[model samples]
Target: MKRSFVALMAFTLLIAIIGFSAHLVVLEINDTHGHAWPYGNYGGFAAIATIVNQVRSEAQANGWDFLFLHAGDVNTGVPESDMLYARPDILALDMMGLNAMTIGNHEFDHPWSVLSRQMAWADFPFLSANIVYKGTDKTVGQPYLIENFPDLKVAILGLTTKTTEYIGNPEYVKGYDFLSPDEVAQKYVPMLQKMVGPDGIVIALTHLGIFGYSEQTVAGTPGAVETAEKLDPPNNPYGGSVSLAQSVSGIAAIFDGHSHTAVTSPFNVNGTLIVQAGSYSKYIARLDLIVENGHVATYTYKLITVSKDIKPNEAIQDLLTAYQIVGSGKLNEPIGYSKVNFANEKDSTRKADTLIGHLITDAVAWKFKDMGVQAVLMNGGGIRAPIPAGTITYKTVLTVLPFGNTVVILKIKGSDLLKAIQWGGVYHPEDTGARLNEWGLTYTVTPNGVENILLDGKPIDPDAIYTVATNDYMANGGDNYSMLKNAQQYNTGYVLADVVKEYIEHISPIESYPFTPRWTEVK
Candidate 1:
């Protein structure tokens, strides 16, 4: 009887220790794309900070520890952040106590020299195991970091998308090689596990776009499912070509960005959990992980929208207000004024027609008309927002074209242009570029219908090689238009934002027109 009682007592002790184990609370926000302020009632860093603080306090009260992380892409959106070279956003994040972050493609939007300087201001460690230094195999940041808890050690690692080679400025990424995520995991996981002594938990922060696949080609056209797939580690001894949650072993939770889609519930893939907060500070994702007796027992995730109703923390609001006040003073200076009004109206949450798309594409085409350019195909996916009605400023120009893309003229056969257009259209039909910027190009976009693209009332001859003016993004085959890379590029030496700014200033106030379907419906 005493033997049985002692055994039962031991079991009870185990349960009590497990219940008292320290729990972890992970908060994630990604794809700010430089949206540091509230745009159209949706996002702002101050509001996000408020929500995070509230949740952190509540979670702490519940015996949980908090770690704030940003998946990547902290640069290039609103005028305030981009105008100062994303300084305000980085400073703001530092004030909020960002724990760790993954290096996103946009981080190299500026010159590498500039990025190197900016890294000094970051409060958290920039993590990317796949990005190797130029001419060396060294990783960009420390591969992994282990945080000690009362009952467990948590190791965090980072991975950047291989697509960064094509998306980022090749000049900045020179001499550097971005290894495959799957390969990196296979090598590093074992090393980290050994170092953690087999009792630690692993987490991966990834910026490899989202899971949803868009089947379209570049040049704003549509066709078969002939497009580049989203980056995922391949199926192997490490894992499958699925989400980071599925591929990397030992990753208990994943924070993802790049595609900008938010997954609130834990996307279960082979028993791993994935969570992503929507982009631009619109949502803060919280993951409550319960570790019992040296193992993860449960993971609860929630997506908290930073709506206006939530009272902004006073301290955060004051900091934001001070920054904006200074930013407004500098940004409000009139470089040029608009004589018309432009608006990007939407039905529900899907993209629709926009006058800004038309004007910007027109400006780009016009800038290179003297160079024998036949047509220009500007990807609608690149257009971030519409120029607001009323006065336009230098800041407005930056917001409209935040990516710092340069203009390049590509020499391509007319046939390839048509093929490219068809691909982009079929995949992202709602996009303005796929819809042919309706205002400038003459084309008919119908599902499975004869793909026809006309320039200046004439069908392009298939055999003719034409000079095409486009941003460097398309020149590098971004948005699944790989064929353009072979096309000889003639640099126009024109800053994309400058050209658009000149056009907007000359066009005066943007005139709002009735919203109409940009693509024709054919039977």
Candidate 2:
């Protein structure tokens, strides 16, 4: 009897060991841009859903776990998604069982109150450990959340970029402070790890751009490479998750977004795996974690394009269709028609006179005319795309200028205006070799071949006063245009898109292309 009992116990132990060898597959998407339907043969909500379902089914068959995550910035690309207030896209995400997401700066491009309201609708928690709430020490979001799958304990912490000025209304983030990623890790990881113990897996879900360090510029060039490499592992006595993943104690991965760039492969910071699923829902990232003894023993990462191989989920398509039915009424209305053919050339510096640019600048000057604004200087880079002549609708406006950038009227001395012009001339190192967009105003290139000062064909004096119309972006020195930072600012609540809409209403549709070059070459 004793011999039989020993043999039975050994058999049970062997079975348990096999059962515990379960693996986890984490799939994530970022910067969907409200594309519920795939563009070309690539992704849409339906096609992505098909991929998710397949991954889940296979994982289940193998006794593995599956999870879905997003890095935010879901709305504002297409007319259907933007006009419907992002409901269709959010509904689709909920159906896909998205566990958690970080709030991107674009999320606040609407209004502060609207952002709070939208957060209420999310099925999964919206997280951000770094954004501070105004007038209090508390953070602006759920700092961290743990998603438990059977025996697996997965912790996801959310973070936004520290540079808030580039994305939204600075006042929107006013009263709220932002903590650095390192600071956040130092503060929270210790306490969380003590509670969850060593078996828990921690991931930082960030909208802080694709590059890992501060020096990782948008163009994928090394920005802070040497500095990042020399930084020591985060000193957390409790063995917390704080490293940049390379040397961070317990962190397993980092999923990043915001640069609108794609990382085709997983980036290894130290020994940690970092992945981003490009923007516009163009791709999905798949990461597999093999856990043993309550820790990640091994891992693998792959990026899957949301292409034709997978079938889109029908349910998501139906939801989008229902929303589109409503949006079609408002978005598809032909506010005005354009008779001229407008094209946005990739290599053009004179972005002036394109139908969309003209319509936008005209709107700006018109909106702020009541506030003593005489001229407008719209940045060419801000003009994302041209107005395709065939059908100009509400949706068209949103895609053309996605950032809900408000127009600000500036009261500045003539010298200040000259400085602004000079700043634009040398904004980037590549400026001299390439021509950037110029509009309305013309300047003379000095014998030095530098952009010298001029306005209305005369040399600009620094102390003379001028009324200028520009967007809040330039006012805050975005894109390295720092000269406008000191100009007296006047708030014009009128949105650039709304201004365009009014211009369209006033002009109606033209029968022939009426636009001509407004840019003047330096004589």
Candidate 3:
């Protein structure tokens, strides 16, 4: 009897030890934006695959439960990937063994047909709990995925930013509704929790962004802080990942994207962990968690730069090379040359009027000059890359403007035009993508609003009817340019990239344009 009792005790203790302790390693990347190839030693899918394989192998060797997730925005940015409709990226991500990815606004850059085709090509599920067919409960993709391990179960719920309704191409996203993230999580978290059972972890894989770390309210959008704190209605209009963490009881962590923010360390908000790996495939975020009694007891987080130092994975590298060869055949044709570089970095163009901004707006205005288009307006977000000094090619122009937006002429009242300009200039001009670039008009941004608005060197008459050239995206009210939504619009049926290329070609050996600032700011 004594021997039997001792043996029983030993068995019970071993069971407890095995059940109560476990190791989990999660690798995440967000907003990759079609960087399947390396940019001068910075980032590429091949390098990312090598890192993922290495870490996955390490995890297996260490007996840790492993997961690889993408927070979203895997499309757009690179002409090589864009030309192929991001098929190369989808294939490479599948080869890398991606467990899951959320839907990003850029996923809708192309029409639904393209997105559906990409979805069919991908092995892993594209998750989004908040996107649904209009007036229906049917979700566009899997709402959440449950992964079971030896001693732990993890439920990942995907949430996309609500801004997709206005930020995405309207025609492409017409039939889909971007439901409130918090509301969707509220409905899903409890169900997920019940499924995972006690001690299991629930995480939000989100595309919602952090607009500003210091201010909860930036450009009238609720950021992570505001969302977490549950600010008033006007302030907390759009709930983000932080909001999901705070409002939902069971979520343990959130991996987020869409503001291109690189969170160096995990943000602990309301006992939930939030992290973003930034954009452009530049970094991979790794989180190591220790699970005790089915709950996360401790963790360590870091952002690893995907630099050229790492050897590329052979298979992924070969796949990307094949796609590059195909893409290069059409994109490499030289169109013109620039005497000086035109800067269009996100930070530069989005804050102040830039040379590239001028060039693009000028191109649009020039295209419709015969139609009596007096001025041009463009959203800085539409401009993606800088035009380097030498050897401009079709690839170069396409890289700068990949959305394929068409030039639109709107007969808008001058009052409404001023409103649009003010909305762009005064509303968090520093980071908002809606910041405006102009041609044939000049304005000064003031603390109150815009002042000294001029068209053709004369003050804009409020009641005068004016023809303004802008992309179809904005004319269709993209980027929250509501003032232009009701205006009379005529689509020129010309792709903006082609128009810019033609303009550059026409003005080849492009050395200097009017350098006078089209817009200025007052302290």
Candidate 4:
């Protein structure tokens, strides 16, 4: 009887220990894309810092653990940040006390020299477990970071999308191998679990995206949901955060980027909570978790909009202001004016021909008209933003074309061009970045393939060679357009933004341009 009573007392003690709760607050931002300054009264490093600081202070006062994380893509998108090699953005993040960040695909947009320099400038480590030097096990950056709290330890692992190999600049990422995230996670997660012990939590910080197979039908890249569910072939051709969650067993939650999704409520997949804040620093995701007996017992999530109501942090604002002033002087100079808005919204540009698409392609066609370039093709994804009707500045032009890609003229047989057009229109009616925007050509998108192919109003002759102008990205097989890779090529060495700027200046009062349907879909 005495021994039984002792066992009961011990079990009661265990239950008490398990019931003890610890509070943890995590703030995450993904795909900032160098919008350090607020636009349209939403998002800015200064404003983001203010909210982060407040949360950090509150957590400190309450004896709760706090973490501030960025999911990646800190480079590109803004002229002020891009011209300075994202110095201001990195400095501002450092000042904001960012704990860690993932290495996004866009990080590979420039040469290794630029990325290496940017890495050296940041205070926090850039994490990616699957990105390894070619033919070696060596990683480009820290794979995961371990943070210790009074009650438990947290393991944060970083995984980038395998699509980086193709979507990222091929020239720059040639030295690295983007391994499948699921394979890497399966290998490392168990090790992380053992290191953290049973009670500790393992979290995935990824740039793998959250869209499911249906959303990315053509690309066959699975999102967090598809990955988590482990959808079969054609749906989840490439693994994602979701796959990691299902394939591996130790992860408590996942913070992801890449799809630019605004996950208002956390997605609970295979007992793992997944969250992603929309891109461009427009939203900050706050996750408050209650940990008990080494597991997440309860949680709440909110995607905080970086509205103007939130006052900007003075210190961060001052730092960004200096850089902004330097670039603003040249970028803000009025270059031209537009009578009507040239819409470049992602869905509009990718699904159908738009005015902005026509304007950009027309500019390219105009620049190389003397070179006998018959038509120009620009990837819909390349048109980053819209040009609202008003004064157009160099900044506006740069914002639209931020990749610094030069123009390339290719000589290809009409048959090859048809393949390229068909590939571009394969995902018609559905938004895809690979869709081609054309000038000086028109075609019909049929269920089977492209038809009515015409160049300058004449039916294209399959055996004839045609001169086509496109960006260096496409000429080198970017966006999976491999048809043009082997074609005869001439690199013009002119920055696309500068070309567009010159065109805008020459056509100043930019009243209108050809808006004819470049491609029509026939169901």
Candidate 5:
């Protein structure tokens, strides 16, 4: 009689579930970079909201649970958003009613005061488990948020990329150390297990990326070493979002960001779904899950392109339009024109010099020549975008040099400079951050070290002190350039973007600038 009763109860539950079909839907967007308007063919926050609302409306009509999530980097790109301290993005996200978000590296682009104020305005929780108060175990931001759907509860863990310590503006991220994602995952998953139990879904909403690191040895390449040591950082700590997910148990999926990838489908690893949406709000990631008995039974995914065809939310569109009118007065002012197009792709800058590299480095050296600056060095990773042929505006210059680092004049011996360059270039081509873009000196960079460094058609004097003009980022030992950490430095009090814009305006119709042949293979 007991067995019969148990079967009857099971049948009744199944019948109930079948009668009321239910689903869990997760909508994700990542690395938005403040493209809140239709950028050429890519994005507009109004359209994004429209699509999101439509999807939600349909889901609700069908009795499905819905969650709208943003991965990170919703700021620091478009002039309309960035110039106003990224408030447009915050306002738009609030209007859209974002459920949760992971704090991205760009969140630290502004000063702490500004960042704090911005965070205060956000409607949803900004999450990062690994980012802690300096020398303390407290998170710099909220660690995670929980969403309870009918019959199932999900705990979403948030982790920022560990690279923010050195890669972001140095002063902004000072005194804080980003803990390893693996350690963070190991620390939190156990507690989460107690809270959510075995049947609940645990999702990691992380900004740590799948940065295409490979462990397999490729001849004469540093990528593998970086991958191995990076995968398991110092103290044998785990690194990257994937490593964190693979190390921890019970995580059902990881909605990842920071690489600016457009993953059309989930990258499944060890039964966990790792997914990323394209950067700049180009697409919205839709993850559909079928829950059975308080557990995810199966899932499918799609990336909805924020194409021009979609209608935008009228309110958001009006707000963006107003902001654009207010911000565009000077930003849209034509600075100059360049007839020649120059590639600034990271690989191009790291492997060999491009015209854009030459233009920036030359501008730095030329702008500060009166101070006896011998050469100027900027990181290849610093060159954010290519200088397109034809019209160039103030906004264009800002996008290229967005960090707002000041020109730092430093006195350094050639030997120490070489060490700094070599240290920074330890993983050239494979690592763009280490590739030094410079003017007033031409050097052939190899995997082994820097050689053939020329100054005035002569070899660099190792003992002689030379005046170097570089952004404060490197002068402050950013990107692991330890040798540059203690150099005799002077703050020029000039923002890098202003200097670049000035140069462009001064040299109005720039017809051509060729490669000075930096980063030779030296075979």
Candidate 6:
């Protein structure tokens, strides 16, 4: 009887110890497009600091540990952030005390020199396991980082989206070759596991998108069943985060970004849990894990909204105040008022028409009116964010047309013009340089073919030569618009954003330029 009682007591003791062994809090924020200050009570870096500090304190009080991580895309949306070369955003994040972050595709939007400077400025390592320096095997950023706590050890491996090569400024990423995340994972995951042993947890902090942005039926698009086990990142990893979690083992969870989707729950696939916090400094994703015997015994995911109710961190708030005083004074000067919400060029531009695109193209056309340019062709890739319905600011203009592209007029054969329109329409569903949004021209594009090519409301003569206004990027054959490579280029010194600013200020109370179905994609 005593033997059985002692055995039962030992079993109960084991249960108690297992339940109280270790508590780990993983805090994540991603896709924070430079929203350092609150906009109508939503999103601010001060609030994020408040939440992080609160969570960290709470975890410590409970005899647990915490990690603060940012996924990617830290800047490039707000004028306050971008105009100063993302300095405000970078400084704010550095002060917020982030443990580490992965490199997003947008990080490559600036010059390589600028990227190098930002990497140096950061307090934490910018992680990217797959990105290798040009002509060398060295990883550009910290391929992986290890953190040791009293009770547990954590291994973090970072991977940038392969799309960074194309989606980012082509010129900026010319030297670096981004390797496959899957191949990188196969090598690193095992090495990490061997180092940490069974009790440690391995995590993939990746900037690869969770899903394709558009779900609208794209005509002439493929519908084949793809899986991570069979297909590589090159063959369509179908949202690299989900794909890798399904295929790779030993990864406890994936903290992901680039899609801006608020993933609240722990999505279990094949044994791994994948989660992503929403974007724009709006929410802090808290992933809690109870680790024992080198395995996650229990886990929970929480998306803590950065609402106004949470008191802002005083120090961080003060720093942001100084930045806002300068940036807002410059950016907030009301240029005009808009009659409509200039939507983000995500879903609408991918398949159909968007007023924001029209406004930009129209501005470009009007800017070169004296030059006798028959039409304006603005590459959809250049349109960054959308304008909300209301008072428009210079900041709004900057955010809408962030890239500092200048106007360059080109002379192209009418046949090549048709090809330009066809090129933009060809990659429907899949975003590419070919998605040309234009003004002073109209065309109907279906999966079958292009038709009704009109220039100045007249049928385009395939052989007639025409002067066309386009951005310098496209004229240089960015996004595979190869036809314009050898065109007679007429350089216009006007910056695209400045042109847009002039157009808006020139016409106050700017009415919603009626979005006629100029570029129709028949699904």
- Residue-level lDDT tens digits of model 5 in 406-433: 9999999888887876665445423456
lDDT per residue (tens digit) for residues 1-523 in model 3: 9999999999999977765667889999988888889998685899999999999999999999999999999889999998888899999999999999999999999988998998999999999998999999899989999999987899999999888998898878889989988888888988998988876888889998764542121221235345435431222437566666666677788998887777777767667788888778888989998977657799998889999888999999999999899979779999998888898664567678788898898888887889999899888888888999999999999999999899988999989988888888764622366888888888888877888888999988889899989998888888888899878988989999999999999999887766778888897
10 residues in a row with least lDDT, candidate 6 = 216-225
Error of 4 at 393 (Å): 0.6
Total backbone clashes of candidate 2, pairs 3 or more residues apart or in separate chains: 17
The alpha-carbon lDDT assigned to residue 388 of candidate 3 equals 93
Each candidate's TM vs. the true structure? 0.81, 0.80, 0.93, 0.92, 0.90, 0.86
**Candidate 2 residue lDDT tens string, 1-523:** 9999999999889866753444889898887877786676775888888889899999999878888888878766776776656778887888888888888766765667767766777788888887887556687778888877777777788877665533344446544666566667656766666655556677778776533332122221233333333342443221112234543456667787765546555655655566677777778889898976556688877788888667668888787778778777877777777766556664132322355556677677666667766567766656655677766887677667666777777888776676666555432421221122333456544434446445555666677777888877667665445566778887677677777777777776756645655443343
Quantify all predictions' global Cα lDDT against the true fold: 0.68, 0.66, 0.84, 0.84, 0.77, 0.78
lDDT of 6 by residue, 129-181 (tens): 88998889899899999999988889999988886765666567778988878
Q: Which stretches of candidate 4 lie over 4 Å from their true place?
A: 1-20, 212-237, 428-431
| Model 3: how far residue 395 lies from native, Å | 1.0
Winning candidate number (TM-score) = 3
Q: Which stretches of candidate 5 lie over 4 Å from their true place?
A: 1-22, 213-238, 345-347, 425-430
In model 2, the Cα lDDT at residue 312 comes to 63
- The global Cα lDDT (0 to 1) of model 5 is 0.77
- For residues 69-182, could you state the per-residue lDDT of candidate 1 as single tens digits? 999989888877776777778888888888888888788777766677667888778888888987688987667677776666787888887767755665566557888777
Candidate with better lDDT, 5 vs 6: 6
CA RMSD of each candidate after superposition: 6.3, 5.7, 3.6, 4.2, 4.6, 5.1
Pairs of colliding residues, candidate 4: 227-242, 227-243, 228-242, 228-243
